[model samples]
Target chain A: MTANRPLILLTNDDGIHAEGIRYLTIAMEHVGEYWVVAPEAEQSAVGHSITLYDPIKAHEISKNGSFYGYGISGTPADSVKLAIHSLLPRVPDLVISGINNGANVGINVLYSGTVSAATEAAILGVPAMAVSLAQKKNPPFQWVVPHVERLALWLLKFGLPPGVALNVNIPAIPPEALRGYKLTRQRLAKMRESFEEREDPRGNRYYWLSGEVPIEESDDSLDATALNDGFVSITPLFYDLTAHSHLQDLATALKNLT
Target chain B: MTANRPLILLTNDDGIHAEGIRYLTIAMEHVGEYWVVAPEAEQSAVGHSITLYDPIKAHEISKNGSFYGYGISGTPADSVKLAIHSLLPRVPDLVISGINNGANVGINVLYSGTVSAATEAAILGVPAMAVSLAQKKNPPFQWVVPHVERLALWLLKFGLPPGVALNVNIPAIPPEALRGYKLTRQRLAKMRESFEEREDPRGNRYYWLSGEVPIEESDDSLDATALNDGFVSITPLFYDLTAHSHLQDLATALKNLT
Candidate 1:
């Protein structure tokens, strides 16, 4: 690790104008030479998606010394890809996504555009982290910025593994009131899905996709549990989705399918 | 599995108007009751993304008896979610996506909307399959329909595991001349990314993302290799994404970070 300032690529699932990304940008400004390339619209739940079908439009919003910001017409993953492949001076020393509006814990991480942005960077061999606040409604982010800055500094000092990125969810509490961080695992929480079937003014039928996340916490000290218990959680996430434990069983079961 | 006719949900990334989905619908018409709900426009490389920010519009496009279709204004994953949660009579006996325009083999699967639809269904505990052709241009799909029907029938008879899906890549050769199916694994060949920097007529600088997929055959029996060898390839894919092999090593390395 170098004592010189690290080049950090910052992004989020929320649009560039969101309070979450703004707070994150403020936090990261003092730590390193940073570039922000985020989506123009809120892209929550866009899991690992990249823009391929349409031409992406990137507008430069800021270009000062050691700092740059561009709002992209794509997803979080697209922002990271565009930054790395075109916009940046070089491959960034680290990629940090979010300071997201809500906690991306348990199976939620699978659906998180914030985490997916970080994962995209990690897949290309850059160190990365995805940070989120454990609240659905926007929380006051000023107090959490310092903690995020500190964590980012620590991660820069001690680099992450090549294909691993940290999924960090901080409790929405004051710094003094918050408990310390814990390395945790992902839990399986059921996202109860429901639909609101309605008719448009034209008398045609339509449905609104809506779901409620179960607030029930399990006994394990997983990411969700830590957030529910008022502690900041950091879960290491990877991109290789192979279930090695089931490989042998699958091999046996699929033997006859051939 | 029941001896009765299977209930199948058919979808694709090539929108409702593409010939690929039309051919796929014809193939599955005999296998079971078919419910087709696909994106209204091309959603090709939109990996595992779902629509949350916008109101989803689903319009019924087919009126054939026991054959229903919907045109959804969402990604491939969103189509599947809408089908399972609200549109279908019950959970589908099997979920099949594509007959997509190009091959979704190797690392290309990570960015494929076709495979992500199947992955979403698999994560929800449905038996799923994602089928694609190894051709960039649209080939005569009439010959491929019979082979797809056979594969679908086979899957309906022998169900897949809870969280796994078969990514089937078919050779574009005529069905009569093509070799038989081969059970294979995902190849490691990645699309080499190259940025084509361009200037708009209005004098704004932007980039058009372009990349070429190198056809280096990693193994003779891998998914990409099988398609290159004139055979259909069926690779079982899972969604866990945890690199369990490196978990212990990662834990040790992460412990040192503190």
Candidate 2:
């Protein structure tokens, strides 16, 4: 999975210490000159948010006495922005986020810090991609490493359009059991959430948000479905929020507004 | 602006106490039955994030000896989620977010907490709209009151397709100076950001993100342009991130992947 030596910026929502990023950093070394500017702590689910109200601080971090990169006190978007505009010696040729702990597919991608990191770069006119293991807990990330490298290399070679990124999810199966890649689209789906109401030691009642099950959307060509079927699902994603299909009709509808 | 008294869930990113929501809540009374479930403190730029790690807490609030609605210690998305799931007795007919402190036009909508609230409701199968004042400070939200009521009524009458939300931006002008409305698209624009390097009292160096100038994308039909021209800009936004245009091309490019 190793090739061109273009500079790459590596970051994740799982903080600088998560196993997903550490392995990803090691794998990226063969692909390019890589730098890691991730959050000092876990910043999961902090979508496309940036730190505007507070001062952002970052410093060099080392793993086992070897220089890894910088760890910042912010979200995934902040890390990427800070890296591109301030930290890195030069703007990287590509930005790759995660090897996230779980998949960012369907409507749930709206809350994904990993995907948002890549989305940030794409908005900044950089080619980017996000990799995730389909499993949520104790995902065997090693099974997805080579596949990640392969796709990342492909992104460098294939050069995505501006404001576009690939949201890639690999099925959490063993290497031998892994199927090939499948290009897919985000599913029209809903995540069923349940809150656990509890009383604290101080006698205050609180709610912990839990239980997200992807409910419907039975499209075989969709990202979630492709992942469920053991393929490396690559969904080409963009952030042009305009509902172009509804634009003209809406214009006509609102034409007579006072 | 008064019409059918539909049940509307009102929320904002600027906290419940902001003049924007206070005015919005009061204005909503003429249009429908409203319940304001919003963040206890300002939650600007907190995209679609929800509180998962911490237990969310919400309680009733009142203004001028009158009962308001619930305010929660969470993001705008969290407020909407908790409102829909646990706070409200039944699902609301429509959800309206903001009368935000600043314009959420162009690509900036991706990081807007106000828009995210409406987006969360839209994802949950409820019709939603987000209203933003083009001014960043001391915006005369009263100028927006009738227009907001108007468009909101239009939304109820001419319902949006599922997974879609209207991002509305009102020009920061007086009633007499206000131009009419325009149906616009989100501008493909970049916000030129500058970070200020500063020294703390303790002599530590940090960077504070400060400048954000919307640069380029000279499209007359864009939301930013319309607002700048003293018109109300209504943009139909849906968060299906799939890059459908590039899907087939990407599949062909990756067909021979090993």
Candidate 3:
């Protein structure tokens, strides 16, 4: 635990071979001593799920001609858990999940494997952040690499409070054209989703989950809006699911139940 | 859309054929019209995941020579999404997820497919509650059926606040020996986990995620403690992951990051 050279654990929901983490590892190399531990396959939308009731296999992954990190047959949460508890030589000072393939904003935060990995790290008493490039497909990871490096360095200097992790989203645009960062809240705008119905070869009716129909939003202080307007979005997130605001009212209402 | 006959959508993470869901259906039948749409395979701890890239297939399932409901090859979240958006007769009056075999308390709520299914419904503007019998194996759903019925009747009369879902955990005790229900907050106790290492037929080492070491906790109001002491724990939860308390401090700390 050298104060000068912090141990930064690197992970992603995308498979170990994904371009995002590869670029992120290259970026974090300058920030601190980076150790990579991530899923063996793409684990998008897996949330905080862990592999229980089954055996998980972790293999040492290598890139080019050298060792990369460990690739585990588990969810993003599993990767972080395994890395912190069993793999890392010592506890990491900071954990960075992603440089994800797509922006994780709005309700996506609850369903995202990228953010979940960071959440796991935070729960395990580490300063963590989940970063995402706004592009859904074929994102320019190099353009955003410096931005991630800058933010991660800042994060290493200014540690996250206990039980908190940052959900960061960068706009998918040329760095020259991009605006600066903005502190934002996760969007609560109504999103409508429908499924795509199809018949497989066996005459069975199947449905593929479709995209969200983005409802109109009048609020500009939300993460979704900030990303669309060419700003990097940083929303501090925590894992506590309790509706603290509704606690009193809920107690009063449910008192009549029994 | 009659108010008296509430249309209740039933689902679980333990798959459609799990005894928990079967008992849940029977319990809901007395409350209102019950429609069962659930995953064909066990999806415990899947969290709020929905299958996006994969095609989801659904088939009509019948129990006791009668049409039971639809079974889908999807997650608990996917089942709820498909049911509300496409499959159901109308928007369900309420969605009750579980009669799950295990408790969803503290951090488990974030990783529980049962709680996540209810959470998905709450997001889609429906009153929802996830019911878990705090028994890990062979949970007797019979004792808790009447209690669930009473709770459902109460919920029908007094609707939940918007953006809120209830995570209900009943103790795994007998009806007479059980202590009364208590409104509880999600536990924040620390848990230590270790993985068991084993070798497969091919001499490949694999690890199975093991149970948590329950650090001694003194907080009686937390869901985990309440459940342990033979009390039903109802924690109101929301999907917004923002660390509202830390937002101001975080904003001030990162102001110099740029």
TM-score of each: 0.91, 0.96, 0.97
In terms of DockQ, the best-performing candidate is 3
* Clash pairs for candidate 2: none
True contacts kept of each: 0.42, 0.73, 0.79
| Model 2 lDDT tens row, B171-204 | 8888898788888999877789867877779886
Question: What lDDT does each candidate get?
Answer: 0.80, 0.86, 0.88
Docking class of predicted structure 3: high
Interface RMSD of each: 2.6, 1.5, 1.1
Model 2: per-residue Cα lDDT over A1-258, one tens digit each: 224468889999999988998878767867888899999999988888988898998877898899988889989999998899888887788898998988888877889999999999999888999999988899998887788778778777878877899898988888778678899998877788877788779887678888888786778899999898888899988998899999988878886565
lDDT of 3 at B258: 70
Point out the higher-scoring one by TM-score: 2 or 3.
Answer: 3
Put down candidate 1 lDDT per residue, B114-191, tens digits, no spaces. Answer: 999998888778888898987878576786798778878877877877788888888888867787777777775445
Stretches of candidate 3 exceeding 4 Å from the true structure:
none
Instruction: Show model 2 residue runs off by greater than 4 Å.
Output: A1-4, A201-203, B1-4, B201-203
Question: What DockQ number belongs to candidate 2?
Answer: 0.72
